[model samples]
Target chain A: MKKHILTGTLTALLTLGGLSVPALAGPEDVVVENAWSRASIGMNRPGAAYMTISNTGDEPVTLIGLATPLAMMPEIHETKTNAEGVSSMSPAGEIVIAPGESIALEPGGLHAMLMRLQEPMTEGDTFPLTLLFDDGGEVTVEVPILSIAARGPED
Target chain B: MQRRAILGYGAAGAGAVALMLFVGWWQVDGPGGPEPIGQRPVALTAMDFRLTDHEGNVVGPETLIGRPTMAFFGFTYCPDVCPTTLSDISGWLDDLGDEADEMNVVFITVDPERDTVETMAEYVGYFHPAIRGWTGPEEQIARVADGFRATYVRVPTESGDYTMNHTASVFLFAASGRFVTMIDYHEPREFAVPKIRRALEEETEGAT
Candidate 1:
């Protein structure tokens, strides 16, 4: 509720401020917005990336995997909390985005899990992450590293 | 003779009724009456386990005594919830100002195989200075988790590696080592800080 309003307002304000969003690469029909990640606590620990991927084309697209130099292994993982409040993570296999549909990989849910980071992801830093699709399409987006406690990109 | 036997049975039945009423009243209103609803007295110190802190110091339940303690369970490999919760705790400690010194904020790792003492030291250093990370033998971790009423499981992922599924709530304890309440995952700062304050308040009340 409030988060949606805040995000919408932030997007509107950013548009009004004349700040352009990150440029979409490869297939322009697939839009990636709010690509963001948190600073890692240590170089040895893992980090995460989140964003909303919208497929505006006439056909469905499957997100196959992710690639980044920041970490040794970057894969799509889904964090699930059961009824007992025990949270777990598992590899999220290729996610299919239907036409005119959007898939959001957010905190406490589906996200790009970066394992064994080469260096600590510090605040105020940016990195390039390539998202691969099953159709031989790829999209590279610039992910801004925010504070470790940041809940969203705008935060 | 039959009437006398009947009278004796009736008298015994009356005595039994009186005894039940007395026992029921004693449980409800006696000197050692039942605790108020939702107030279950839990002694956290009763859990006996030993583990080394990030600083390589062997610590047990005794270390938690004499301070309001906050403990959470997770793995260092965890990317989202663990770091987010730790950062949130750091913010709470910042809001506490000088009062934070009197608290014990601990992060216990369920994945002892990966989270060594050195790993924990570097990990906790990123958060509040007051935070301490604890890791030990897998059996000891299990013992501590059992005592804290927490749970965790090792889940194998596709990359020939594994992840942990663990309890996500932060447990609070009073200075006397009595279990307080829990702060759920992603709980807002407004509610989380007050819970910590209440644990501190318990110490004040106990002092006098």
Candidate 2:
């Protein structure tokens, strides 16, 4: 039962990685590293996933989708603030990775919102996740879940 | 010989009971619980505002009154401060165990344009479910922010994304909703948990 719940939560967070294909797929390269989920305890519903993405190709590549067996749906998302002094989170259409550059999806910034957990995420658990890019290429990664208290602001 | 043995057993039992009581009392009054802020006492003032939770419920100061409340002002879009702070609160609550039941945790959105009741709820839900989220109309939110002395400003970027710069502090209120102290953003566990323990103990003692 616990395993099912953890899987469900990861599925919800990974659901955001899916996006429409971009017009130009300049480079065929994308790499994700250090992807992990924020640790939480009982009755906690949603969590955030963080990682670093590196584009090693000569041309820029866009990350469009993410997938994992843990969720029902996944979509690309970004946090944006409006003029009325309100901050909101919405689906990111595409995340562009420049050539030889890396984007850090750390806390307080662009992160994967793992929504609608099937189970509570305890500390010391790991979930398997996959990142899908526009050029039909994908990377499989393991996200370690840690205690919410252990996560620092910079992480 | 039998009578002497009974007396000895009675003495041992009494000693054991006394030791247990001492340990229990020490744990309750230990240094790890909430402590009073030695500096200026934070004043809790009431402000009326409208905001929503992830489940789309209306929330304001009134919702925080029944229990000792720990409130923080932040936006869901904050890249670093908001999530880390809230995550710390969640961890502290876990460490608190049953003590959390007597406290109400609140996350107030400074940016209400995007943080409708539903959005606030969704955002807050990422943390512990016991934490309540509130955000209302812009004017009302502004009033509440001012009352708490929390600050927020929006800066625009070329990519069509904007960032909000705001003060990050957790405010603790008595069960009666009087301001207690502000937990600095960086050391919530070290600073905030002890204050919460102190508040709960004080409330319990007062009731007795």
Candidate 3:
């Protein structure tokens, strides 16, 4: 009887603290959502993945790199267009997310460039991706491959 | 008296229908629609450069002159923008249906170092069958880009590799080899198809 009461009290305390459900959800403080990629055009072509990373904890976290079995080298890249409407892509450095903030990796902006894809990423395919953090921790996400003309996760 | 009242309502209804028709025409052809930036067509003959197509045939601006042309500059390595644009072009062509055969669509490479003839051939094959991939010497690419007033630059990445920065607009030209207008990147198909149709119509009228 006492053990049961103690367990009930602990659950009540956790619920009152507003950390019961979400705290038990994942071990990492960062949350990755809407991970998606477009289908590869053809063989020997590269691919890209986009997602939104949210730092749910009170401390800031840094995203250092990415990894996937599908690509030879998965790197964070960003596409920037100039004032004259010239677009370019370059490797992106470490991304820092403050507590309660979210960083969106989207089209025409920061994204994961999958270099030298092992095979063509076909539509209706899903793959696992790992996001390496600065503190040696990582988060794994499932990325879904959409149509080549897909503009976002919703598509 | 009731019959006259009914006739009066019918007359008002017809007048309203006519007004709506006029308003619709005004929206389509008036200042609301897309307007050509340049009043005069820029002659493609003014530019002279040679590049090889994906099929390994040497082609110059003269080859593009006889048909309504839609040209874009991008590299095969481009993952997001280039592929998306190519897919959008395919959708546009699909929307055009049989009329697509009346146009010349070309994909010019800004990164000549990586996009060889073979690479371009494989890359373009994934898109609309009508698209012709072109690549050649860097200087010749520059010559063609200058003729179109398009710009490109090489940008180095942190990984010691490089990428290209180039104009994102698709240039449209009439069969007379004259510049008609530019279709901005990510422009919706509803607007893009009409621009292409206008270019094609310009050619058809010229032929007549």
Writing each residue's lDDT as its tens digit, candidate 2 over B119-186 gives 67666767877788877788887877767766677765333556566666677877766777767654
- Candidate closer to the true structure by TM-score (higher is better), 1 or 3: 1
lDDT of 1 at A128: 74
Give the number of the best model, judged by lDDT: 1
| Tens-place lDDT digits, model 1, residues B1-208 | 9999999999999999999999988988986575543333256678888899999999988999999999989888889878877878888999999999999999999999999999999888878999999999999999988787778999876556788899888889999999988887756789999999999999999888
lDDT per residue for candidate 3 within B169-195, as digits (tens), equals 788999999899888775677999999
- Residue-level error in angstroms, candidate 3, position A143: 2.1
For model 2 the local lDDT of residue B183 reads 72
Decreasing DockQ order of the candidates: 1, 3, 2
What is every candidate's alpha-carbon RMSD to the true fold?
Answer: 12.2, 21.7, 18.8
List runs of model 1 lying over 4 Å from the truth: A1-22, A40-44, A55-61, A97-102, A116-124, A134-136, A147-151, B1-42
lDDT by residue for model 2 (A37-74), tens: 76643432345677778887798777887776554444
Candidate 1's error at B45, in angstroms? 2.0
Write down the TM-score of every candidate: 0.75, 0.51, 0.71
Chain A accuracy as TM-score for every candidate: 0.86, 0.69, 0.82
The reply for model 3, stretches above 4 Å from the true place, is A1-33, A39-45, A54-62, A96-103, A116-125, A134-137, A146-155, B1-42
